[model samples]
Target: MTTHTPTTPEQLLEKLTALGIEATTINHPAVYTVEESKAHRGDLPGAHTKNLFLRNKKGKMWLLVCLEDRKIDIKLLGKALEAGKLSFGSAARLMEFLGIEPGSVSPFSAINDREGQVKVVLDTQMMTQSPINAHPLTNTMTTAITPTDLVRFLESIDHAPEELDMNNLAELATKAE
Candidate 1:
Protein backbone atom coordinates (compact mmCIF):
# COMPACT_ATOMS: atom_id res chain seq x y z
CA MET A 1 0.00 0.00 0.00
CA THR A 2 1.27 3.42 -0.87
CA THR A 3 1.58 5.87 2.03
CA HIS A 4 -0.03 9.30 1.80
CA THR A 5 1.69 12.53 2.69
CA PRO A 6 -0.11 14.88 5.04
CA THR A 7 -0.62 18.50 4.06
CA THR A 8 1.74 20.83 5.84
CA PRO A 9 0.76 24.25 7.26
CA GLU A 10 2.49 25.99 4.37
CA GLN A 11 0.61 23.95 1.78
CA LEU A 12 -2.71 24.68 3.44
CA LEU A 13 -1.88 28.36 3.37
CA GLU A 14 -1.08 28.05 -0.30
CA LYS A 15 -4.48 26.45 -0.92
CA LEU A 16 -6.16 29.31 0.87
CA THR A 17 -4.28 31.78 -1.29
CA ALA A 18 -5.21 29.98 -4.48
CA LEU A 19 -8.83 30.31 -3.40
CA GLY A 20 -8.29 34.06 -2.91
CA ILE A 21 -8.89 33.72 0.80
CA GLU A 22 -6.91 36.20 2.83
CA ALA A 23 -5.66 34.69 6.07
CA THR A 24 -3.09 35.61 8.67
CA THR A 25 -1.01 33.07 10.55
CA ILE A 26 0.84 33.34 13.83
CA ASN A 27 3.39 30.84 15.00
CA HIS A 28 3.89 29.74 18.55
CA PRO A 29 5.07 26.84 20.65
CA ALA A 30 3.14 23.69 19.78
CA VAL A 31 -0.02 23.42 21.78
CA TYR A 32 -1.74 20.08 22.28
CA THR A 33 -4.91 21.37 23.91
CA VAL A 34 -7.16 24.40 23.83
CA GLU A 35 -6.11 25.42 27.32
CA GLU A 36 -2.50 25.18 26.34
CA SER A 37 -3.19 27.44 23.33
CA LYS A 38 -4.61 30.24 25.46
CA ALA A 39 -1.17 31.35 26.62
CA HIS A 40 -0.04 31.80 23.02
CA ARG A 41 -2.87 33.74 21.34
CA GLY A 42 -1.69 37.06 22.68
CA ASP A 43 -4.30 39.71 21.71
CA LEU A 44 -5.49 38.10 18.52
CA PRO A 45 -8.90 39.57 17.87
CA GLY A 46 -11.27 36.84 16.82
CA ALA A 47 -12.84 33.57 17.83
CA HIS A 48 -10.41 30.75 18.42
CA THR A 49 -11.66 27.26 17.72
CA LYS A 50 -11.77 23.85 19.37
CA ASN A 51 -12.11 21.04 16.86
CA LEU A 52 -13.35 17.49 17.33
CA PHE A 53 -13.14 14.45 15.09
CA LEU A 54 -15.99 12.14 15.96
CA ARG A 55 -17.46 8.96 14.59
CA ASN A 56 -20.63 7.06 15.23
CA LYS A 57 -20.92 3.28 15.29
CA LYS A 58 -21.94 3.17 11.64
CA GLY A 59 -18.66 4.77 10.51
CA LYS A 60 -20.23 8.14 9.83
CA MET A 61 -17.77 10.84 10.81
CA TRP A 62 -17.99 14.52 11.69
CA LEU A 63 -15.48 17.32 11.94
CA LEU A 64 -16.77 19.91 14.41
CA VAL A 65 -15.20 23.35 14.57
CA CYS A 66 -16.61 25.47 17.34
CA LEU A 67 -15.71 28.33 19.62
CA GLU A 68 -12.91 27.42 21.97
CA ASP A 69 -15.06 28.15 25.01
CA ARG A 70 -18.11 26.19 23.87
CA LYS A 71 -18.86 23.15 26.00
CA ILE A 72 -19.91 20.03 24.12
CA ASP A 73 -21.77 17.00 25.41
CA ILE A 74 -21.27 14.01 23.20
CA LYS A 75 -24.46 12.19 24.16
CA LEU A 76 -26.66 15.22 23.63
CA LEU A 77 -24.90 16.15 20.43
CA GLY A 78 -25.39 12.61 19.17
CA LYS A 79 -29.09 12.83 19.84
CA ALA A 80 -29.26 16.29 18.32
CA LEU A 81 -27.47 15.24 15.15
CA GLU A 82 -29.10 11.79 15.07
CA ALA A 83 -25.58 10.44 15.19
CA GLY A 84 -26.09 7.76 17.78
CA LYS A 85 -23.36 6.79 20.22
CA LEU A 86 -20.78 9.27 19.00
CA SER A 87 -17.20 8.77 20.12
CA PHE A 88 -13.94 10.53 19.45
CA GLY A 89 -12.34 9.15 16.33
CA SER A 90 -9.03 7.44 16.99
CA ALA A 91 -5.76 9.11 16.08
CA ALA A 92 -5.23 6.56 13.31
CA ARG A 93 -8.72 7.16 11.95
CA LEU A 94 -8.20 10.88 12.10
CA MET A 95 -5.11 10.51 9.99
CA GLU A 96 -6.87 8.09 7.68
CA PHE A 97 -9.85 10.34 7.12
CA LEU A 98 -8.44 13.85 7.43
CA GLY A 99 -4.71 13.35 7.27
CA ILE A 100 -4.31 14.98 10.66
CA GLU A 101 -3.37 13.92 14.17
CA PRO A 102 -5.43 14.23 17.37
CA GLY A 103 -4.12 17.58 18.53
CA SER A 104 -4.03 19.04 15.05
CA VAL A 105 -7.63 18.36 14.10
CA SER A 106 -8.82 21.18 11.84
CA PRO A 107 -11.74 21.96 9.56
CA PHE A 108 -9.09 23.16 7.14
CA SER A 109 -7.90 19.58 7.02
CA ALA A 110 -10.95 18.92 4.88
CA ILE A 111 -8.64 19.45 1.93
CA ASN A 112 -7.16 16.03 2.58
CA ASP A 113 -10.55 14.37 2.66
CA ARG A 114 -10.75 14.14 -1.10
CA GLU A 115 -13.46 11.51 -0.82
CA GLY A 116 -15.51 13.93 1.30
CA GLN A 117 -15.94 11.30 4.02
CA VAL A 118 -16.23 13.68 6.94
CA LYS A 119 -19.12 16.09 7.42
CA VAL A 120 -17.84 19.47 8.48
CA VAL A 121 -19.73 21.59 11.01
CA LEU A 122 -18.93 25.18 11.85
CA ASP A 123 -20.31 26.77 15.01
CA THR A 124 -22.87 29.48 14.31
CA GLN A 125 -21.65 31.70 17.09
CA MET A 126 -18.08 31.13 16.13
CA MET A 127 -18.77 31.85 12.50
CA THR A 128 -20.37 35.12 13.50
CA GLN A 129 -17.06 36.16 14.99
CA SER A 130 -14.57 37.63 12.57
CA PRO A 131 -11.17 36.22 11.78
CA ILE A 132 -11.92 32.68 12.86
CA ASN A 133 -8.75 31.19 14.30
CA ALA A 134 -7.80 27.55 13.74
CA HIS A 135 -4.77 25.37 13.20
CA PRO A 136 -3.68 25.14 9.58
CA LEU A 137 -3.26 21.35 9.94
CA THR A 138 -0.86 21.67 12.89
CA ASN A 139 -0.97 23.00 16.43
CA THR A 140 2.20 25.08 16.23
CA MET A 141 0.48 27.87 14.30
CA THR A 142 -2.93 29.51 14.02
CA THR A 143 -4.41 30.83 10.78
CA ALA A 144 -6.95 33.60 11.02
CA ILE A 145 -9.49 34.32 8.32
CA THR A 146 -12.79 36.05 7.96
CA PRO A 147 -15.73 33.70 8.34
CA THR A 148 -16.72 34.16 4.72
CA ASP A 149 -13.21 33.33 3.53
CA LEU A 150 -13.09 30.26 5.73
CA VAL A 151 -16.30 28.95 4.22
CA ARG A 152 -15.05 29.81 0.78
CA PHE A 153 -11.88 27.83 1.35
CA LEU A 154 -13.84 24.86 2.64
CA GLU A 155 -16.12 25.01 -0.35
CA SER A 156 -13.12 25.24 -2.61
CA ILE A 157 -12.02 21.91 -1.18
CA ASP A 158 -15.50 20.51 -1.87
CA HIS A 159 -16.20 20.24 1.84
CA ALA A 160 -18.88 22.88 2.25
CA PRO A 161 -19.56 23.11 5.98
CA GLU A 162 -22.82 23.21 7.87
CA GLU A 163 -23.19 26.08 10.28
CA LEU A 164 -25.00 25.15 13.48
CA ASP A 165 -25.86 27.02 16.62
CA MET A 166 -23.75 25.07 19.05
CA ASN A 167 -24.16 27.70 21.75
CA ASN A 168 -27.92 27.27 21.67
CA LEU A 169 -27.47 23.54 21.84
CA ALA A 170 -25.30 23.97 24.92
CA GLU A 171 -27.96 26.17 26.47
CA LEU A 172 -30.62 23.55 25.85
CA ALA A 173 -28.43 20.91 27.42
CA THR A 174 -27.95 23.06 30.49
CA LYS A 175 -31.69 23.57 30.89
CA ALA A 176 -32.21 19.83 30.75
CA GLU A 177 -29.88 19.34 33.67
Candidate 2:
Protein backbone atom coordinates (compact mmCIF):
# COMPACT_ATOMS: atom_id res chain seq x y z
CA MET A 1 0.00 0.00 0.00
CA THR A 2 1.23 3.45 -0.88
CA THR A 3 1.76 5.71 2.09
CA HIS A 4 0.52 9.29 2.14
CA THR A 5 1.78 11.84 4.60
CA PRO A 6 -1.17 13.69 6.06
CA THR A 7 -0.84 17.26 7.22
CA THR A 8 -1.16 17.34 10.99
CA PRO A 9 -3.00 19.95 13.04
CA GLU A 10 0.23 21.24 14.57
CA GLN A 11 1.75 21.76 11.13
CA LEU A 12 -1.34 23.58 9.97
CA LEU A 13 -1.11 25.87 13.02
CA GLU A 14 2.52 26.53 12.28
CA LYS A 15 1.61 27.50 8.74
CA LEU A 16 -0.99 29.90 10.05
CA THR A 17 1.50 31.42 12.47
CA ALA A 18 4.04 31.83 9.68
CA LEU A 19 1.44 33.70 7.69
CA GLY A 20 0.78 36.07 10.63
CA ILE A 21 -2.69 34.71 11.15
CA GLU A 22 -3.73 34.55 14.77
CA ALA A 23 -5.90 31.59 15.65
CA THR A 24 -7.29 29.83 18.71
CA THR A 25 -7.82 26.10 18.70
CA ILE A 26 -9.90 23.90 20.99
CA ASN A 27 -9.55 20.16 21.23
CA HIS A 28 -12.65 18.04 21.54
CA PRO A 29 -14.03 14.63 20.72
CA ALA A 30 -14.32 13.87 17.00
CA VAL A 31 -17.47 15.32 15.53
CA TYR A 32 -18.60 14.73 11.96
CA THR A 33 -21.66 16.95 11.53
CA VAL A 34 -22.62 20.47 12.53
CA GLU A 35 -25.04 19.25 15.15
CA GLU A 36 -22.44 17.03 16.71
CA SER A 37 -19.90 19.85 16.65
CA LYS A 38 -22.28 22.19 18.41
CA ALA A 39 -22.38 19.91 21.40
CA HIS A 40 -18.62 20.20 21.76
CA ARG A 41 -18.20 23.89 20.98
CA GLY A 42 -19.78 25.47 23.98
CA ASP A 43 -19.68 29.27 24.15
CA LEU A 44 -17.10 29.52 21.41
CA PRO A 45 -17.35 32.99 19.97
CA GLY A 46 -17.64 33.38 16.20
CA ALA A 47 -19.58 31.81 13.41
CA HIS A 48 -19.23 28.06 13.16
CA THR A 49 -18.58 27.04 9.55
CA LYS A 50 -19.43 24.01 7.48
CA ASN A 51 -17.26 23.24 4.49
CA LEU A 52 -18.17 21.35 1.33
CA PHE A 53 -15.73 19.88 -1.18
CA LEU A 54 -17.34 19.61 -4.57
CA ARG A 55 -16.44 18.82 -8.16
CA ASN A 56 -18.27 19.96 -11.25
CA LYS A 57 -18.90 18.09 -14.48
CA LYS A 58 -15.96 19.84 -16.12
CA GLY A 59 -13.65 18.60 -13.36
CA LYS A 60 -13.42 21.98 -11.65
CA MET A 61 -13.21 21.63 -7.88
CA TRP A 62 -14.73 23.97 -5.29
CA LEU A 63 -14.46 24.30 -1.55
CA LEU A 64 -17.49 26.10 -0.19
CA VAL A 65 -17.52 27.51 3.35
CA CYS A 66 -20.76 28.64 4.90
CA LEU A 67 -22.36 29.21 8.28
CA GLU A 68 -23.17 25.99 10.05
CA ASP A 69 -26.91 26.65 9.97
CA ARG A 70 -27.20 27.71 6.34
CA LYS A 71 -29.33 25.44 4.22
CA ILE A 72 -27.66 24.42 0.99
CA ASP A 73 -28.95 22.36 -1.91
CA ILE A 74 -26.08 21.06 -4.02
CA LYS A 75 -28.02 21.30 -7.31
CA LEU A 76 -28.99 24.89 -6.56
CA LEU A 77 -25.50 25.73 -5.35
CA GLY A 78 -24.06 24.30 -8.56
CA LYS A 79 -26.24 26.62 -10.59
CA ALA A 80 -25.38 29.57 -8.40
CA LEU A 81 -21.68 28.87 -8.81
CA GLU A 82 -22.15 28.30 -12.57
CA ALA A 83 -20.38 25.01 -12.07
CA GLY A 84 -22.88 22.91 -14.06
CA LYS A 85 -23.95 20.12 -11.71
CA LEU A 86 -21.84 19.44 -8.63
CA SER A 87 -21.14 16.35 -6.61
CA PHE A 88 -19.22 15.71 -3.41
CA GLY A 89 -15.57 15.12 -4.17
CA SER A 90 -14.39 11.67 -3.15
CA ALA A 91 -12.44 11.07 0.07
CA ALA A 92 -9.33 10.28 -1.97
CA ARG A 93 -9.67 13.51 -3.92
CA LEU A 94 -10.21 15.40 -0.68
CA MET A 95 -6.94 14.04 0.71
CA GLU A 96 -5.07 14.49 -2.55
CA PHE A 97 -6.16 18.08 -3.05
CA LEU A 98 -6.65 19.41 0.48
CA GLY A 99 -4.58 16.95 2.47
CA ILE A 100 -7.47 16.16 4.79
CA GLU A 101 -10.17 13.53 5.21
CA PRO A 102 -13.98 13.80 5.09
CA GLY A 103 -14.77 15.21 8.52
CA SER A 104 -11.71 17.45 8.55
CA VAL A 105 -12.42 19.57 5.47
CA SER A 106 -11.94 23.30 6.11
CA PRO A 107 -10.60 26.46 4.53
CA PHE A 108 -7.46 25.87 6.60
CA SER A 109 -6.80 22.95 4.26
CA ALA A 110 -6.04 25.56 1.63
CA ILE A 111 -2.56 25.71 3.13
CA ASN A 112 -1.88 22.29 1.60
CA ASP A 113 -3.32 23.13 -1.82
CA ARG A 114 -0.24 24.78 -3.24
CA GLU A 115 -1.38 24.05 -6.81
CA GLY A 116 -4.57 26.06 -6.34
CA GLN A 117 -6.50 23.16 -7.89
CA VAL A 118 -9.56 23.97 -5.82
CA LYS A 119 -11.57 27.18 -5.84
CA VAL A 120 -12.59 28.38 -2.40
CA VAL A 121 -16.02 29.91 -1.88
CA LEU A 122 -17.17 31.72 1.24
CA ASP A 123 -20.68 32.57 2.31
CA THR A 124 -20.98 36.36 2.48
CA GLN A 125 -22.94 36.12 5.69
CA MET A 126 -20.27 34.08 7.33
CA MET A 127 -17.68 36.67 6.40
CA THR A 128 -19.49 39.33 8.39
CA GLN A 129 -18.47 37.59 11.58
CA SER A 130 -15.18 38.85 12.97
CA PRO A 131 -14.11 35.35 13.98
CA ILE A 132 -14.75 32.12 12.05
CA ASN A 133 -14.39 28.60 13.38
CA ALA A 134 -13.18 25.67 11.28
CA HIS A 135 -11.46 22.34 11.65
CA PRO A 136 -7.68 22.48 12.11
CA LEU A 137 -6.85 19.58 9.74
CA THR A 138 -8.78 17.26 12.05
CA ASN A 139 -12.32 16.92 13.34
CA THR A 140 -11.05 16.65 16.90
CA MET A 141 -10.16 20.33 17.04
CA THR A 142 -11.73 23.62 15.99
CA THR A 143 -9.62 26.61 15.12
CA ALA A 144 -10.96 30.14 15.30
CA ILE A 145 -9.64 33.04 13.26
CA THR A 146 -10.83 36.35 11.95
CA PRO A 147 -12.55 36.32 8.58
CA THR A 148 -9.93 38.75 7.31
CA ASP A 149 -7.17 36.42 8.42
CA LEU A 150 -8.92 33.51 6.77
CA VAL A 151 -8.83 35.36 3.44
CA ARG A 152 -5.22 36.29 4.00
CA PHE A 153 -4.35 32.65 4.72
CA LEU A 154 -6.10 31.47 1.58
CA GLU A 155 -4.37 34.14 -0.50
CA SER A 156 -1.06 33.23 1.07
CA ILE A 157 -1.58 29.72 -0.30
CA ASP A 158 -2.85 30.99 -3.67
CA HIS A 159 -6.47 29.98 -3.12
CA ALA A 160 -8.26 33.27 -2.50
CA PRO A 161 -11.96 32.49 -2.34
CA GLU A 162 -14.98 33.83 -4.16
CA GLU A 163 -17.55 35.22 -1.77
CA LEU A 164 -21.21 34.49 -2.44
CA ASP A 165 -24.31 35.64 -0.64
CA MET A 166 -26.15 32.58 0.59
CA ASN A 167 -29.46 34.46 0.33
CA ASN A 168 -28.74 35.30 -3.28
CA LEU A 169 -27.82 31.69 -3.95
CA ALA A 170 -31.12 30.58 -2.50
CA GLU A 171 -32.92 32.97 -4.80
CA LEU A 172 -30.93 31.81 -7.80
CA ALA A 173 -31.79 28.24 -7.00
CA THR A 174 -35.45 29.12 -6.79
CA LYS A 175 -35.36 31.03 -10.06
CA ALA A 176 -33.62 28.15 -11.78
CA GLU A 177 -36.45 25.85 -10.79
Please identify model 2 stretches exceeding 4 Å from their true place. 1-4, 170-177
lDDT of candidate 1 at residue 26, scale 0 to 100? 89
TM-score to native of every candidate shown? 0.92, 0.92
Model 1 over residues 1-177: C-alpha lDDT tens digits? 235787888999988888888899989999999889998888988999999999999999999999998889888777667677799999888889899877888888988888888999898889888989999999889999999998888888888998877867756445555
lDDT of 2 by residue, 73-159 (tens): 888899888888999999998888888989999998877776778999999999999799999999999999999999998888788
Worst 10 residues of 2 by lDDT: 1-10
Q: What is the Cα-based lDDT of residue 44 in candidate 2? A: 96
lDDT at 121 for candidate 2?
A: 97
Model 1, runs deviating above 4 Å: 1-3, 170-177
